[model samples]
Target: MSGIIGKKIGMTSIYGADGRNVACTVIEAGPCVVTQVKNEATDGYKAIQLSYDERKDKNTPKALKGHFAKAKTTPKKKVVEFRDFREEFEGQVKIGDKIMVGEVFKEAEFLDAIGTSKGKGFQGVVKRHGFAGVGEATHGQHNRLRAPGSIGACSFPSRVFKGIRMAGRTGGDRVKVINLQIMKIMPEKNLIVVSGSVPGAKNSYVILEK
Candidate 1:
């Protein structure tokens, strides 16, 4: 799918034409630079690499500095590739081209927003996996309220099985919200207002695909 790199610029509510308040997420989408163009003949696949956001030259590594120099652009904070870009833009896009949000997306179009969810650090099974705790507060159930009952079969298998839902890490995973409606497009500000919520915290980067 073809898409653009964007940043979540928080969220807000807007009055719709039907006099209803709609919640939307504001995203600073694109003005992304085409950093590299991969072709089947050379890279064994077809994909277009895009770079978004700016990074100071001093903070960028030497190798990456050289890579950005090839595209005649400054160091970027985020770089991602999209395979099988839209057919209309296939032969038109080349290295150093800038793709803006307004050029790619339109209001009312359905899109998929991909981003990393907010991290909740280490968590227990009750909060992490939504496990219903040990029934009632009776039968002398002390700290067994949030415990994960039995882990495995005892005498038969003799060992704990793999893929058991347990408490560990929570959130901070790649999440994709599908069928999000593009409510509005602000071309001058390079912002796209999307209906409903998106993954990740405010100001985090997200990819919008169609």
Candidate 2:
């Protein structure tokens, strides 16, 4: 799949031609720089590595400094590789080439957005796994409201199941939202407005793919 790295620039509602307001997420889909090009002969695979956003030289590691120097670009905050990019780019994209938002996506095109969901830290089963509470608060049920009722049977299994849903860390996982419609494209601002919401918080990086 061909994709571009972008930052979620919050969201807004725009009035459509039918006089209906539609909610959309604004993303700053780059001008991403081609940092590296891998080939089947050398790297054992074909892929194009793209770099987006900028980082200061002082904060960049020594090894990454040389890596970005090879591409003749500044240290990037995010780097991602996409296989089969040559088919979409017609085999013209090389190292140091810049890919803009308008070049990859068009208005009204359906695409997929991949991003890390917002972390909610340690959470209970009620919020994490959507486990319903243990009935009403009657019958002297003091603290059993949000508790996960009986994980395992008595001596039948003798132990809790491995895949049992429990309270634990939530979110902060890679999530893919598919078939998002690109409602508008602002080439000058390097922004693409996609219908509906995307994962992650505002300003977080996301991959928009087609």
Candidate 3:
């Protein structure tokens, strides 16, 4: 897959060809810099690494600063690698070459948006795992409404089994939303709008793969 790194820019609604108002996630996608081009002979795999978003030199790690320097580009806030990259460009892309949103979306009709989902801290079973709580509170069911009902059987292998869906942490995960339709592209603004929602909060980095 070949892709570009982008920043989520909230969402908006727009009319489609069918005269329907379609909800879309707006993303500021690229002018991503090609920071590294890995080959099997070197890194044991073939990949294209792209860097996006500006970052202060002082805030960037020393090693990453050197890495960006090797690419002849400024320090970037996010870096992502795409393996088995599609031949989307006219020719080989070298370090420091910019992959603009318009150029990347020219050959893509749909994209897989990969991003970190908004973190919902520790939550209960009802909210985290969608468990149906004990209803009505009738028949002395107080304080057990949202509680995880049981652990395990009394005497047979009597420990709580793994992955029973008991609640702990929620969200703040790497999520990929596949096959989002290309709703609109404002190349002049280097922005892309895709149908439906994308993972992560506003200003978060998202990788759009084709």
Report the lDDT of model 1 for residue 143: 82
Candidate 1 lDDT over residue span 116-170, tens digit each: 9999999999999999987778888878889888898878999988999998989
Instruction: Give each prediction's root-mean-square deviation over alpha carbons.
Output: 1.4, 1.2, 1.6
What is the C-alpha lDDT profile of model 3 across 35-62, one tens digit per residue?
9998888999889999999999889899
Off by over 4 Å in 2: 17-19, 86-88
lDDT of 2 by residue, 39-110 (tens): 898999888899999999999999999999999999999999988773768568888999999998888889
Q: What overall lDDT, based on C-alpha atoms, would model 1 receive against the true structure?
A: 0.94
Q: What TM-score goes with each of the models?
A: 0.94, 0.96, 0.94
Count of clashes, each model: 0, 0, 0
TM for candidate 2 is 0.96
Clashing pairs in 3: none
In candidate 2, where is summed lDDT lowest over 10 consecutive residues? 84-93
Ranking of all predicted structures according to lDDT, beginning with the best and ending with the worst: 1, 2, 3
Residue clash pairs of candidate 1: none
By TM-score, who's the top model here?
Answer: 2
